[model samples]
Target: MPISHIEHYNLRAERSMLETLRDFYVTVVGLQVGYRPLSSYGYWLYAGERALLHLSEARPGDPREPHLRSTFDHVAFACTDLPACEAHLRNHGIDYRYAEVPATGQRQLFFSDPAGNGIELNFAATPDS
Candidate 1:
């Protein structure tokens, strides 16, 4: 059998960072909190029917790594209506950078969340535009 797509990605975070991550993803990234079902503290963020992002609380004894440079870069989403996205970000006072992909004409919006997690919004050009 062939794998279909990425099911989800888990982010291990300290307790304090959990709420920050939650707010950013919910308010800015446009995800909804869903059933996680884990005994530990954290969240499962859903985009539509599938939970795309998972958060797990790091215990006191868990090793904490300095994120001077994060090895895992950013999560990207394909979105519609670049104008609306820009206005939403502006309304929220979010700082973002925009660029068009080399040849695809896909517009990219890059920004960092409260906990410094990078996110990308890709807006593809529609046909007959």
Candidate 2:
């Protein structure tokens, strides 16, 4: 069978930084936790389905480090109610850039995640439907 959607994502972060990251994902992003297994440090964060975020504990020898340039440029998600979405962002003090996809007349806004990962919120336009 063809794959339906992305199952989850795994990120490596320092043990001391996991809590801050977790709070952002759970509180700000609005993803709920499912389960977490015992681990030496870090944790696995689930959002309704299987674990969506698997945070690995950083080791002394681990070479990976968070960098401003290394973050993903953007990720997009559809919004049924554009006005509500924009208001929500504003209520949270998040900055965003708006635009229109010329030919399709689709509206979109680009914003950043707590970790600085770019995100795009989009909505299809209709005349009077």
Highest TM-score against the true fold, candidate: 1
TM-score of each: 0.89, 0.68
Highest lDDT among the candidates is held by which one? 1
Give Cα distance to truth, residue 86, candidate 1, Å: 0.8
Model 1, range 28-105, lDDT digits (tens) per residue?
A: 889999998888899999999889999888888895442547687788998999999999999999999999876777
TM-score of 2: 0.68
Residues 14-125 of candidate 2 have per-residue lDDT tens digits of 7656677777667655566656676567667764565767767777887445547863677566666778878877887878999999898899989776556676777898
Clash pairs, model 2 backbone: none
For model 1, the stretches where C-alpha displacement exceeds 4 angstroms are 63-67
Off by over 4 Å in 2: 1-4, 37-40, 43-51, 126-129
Tell me the whole-model lDDT of each prediction, alpha carbons only. Answer: 0.85, 0.71
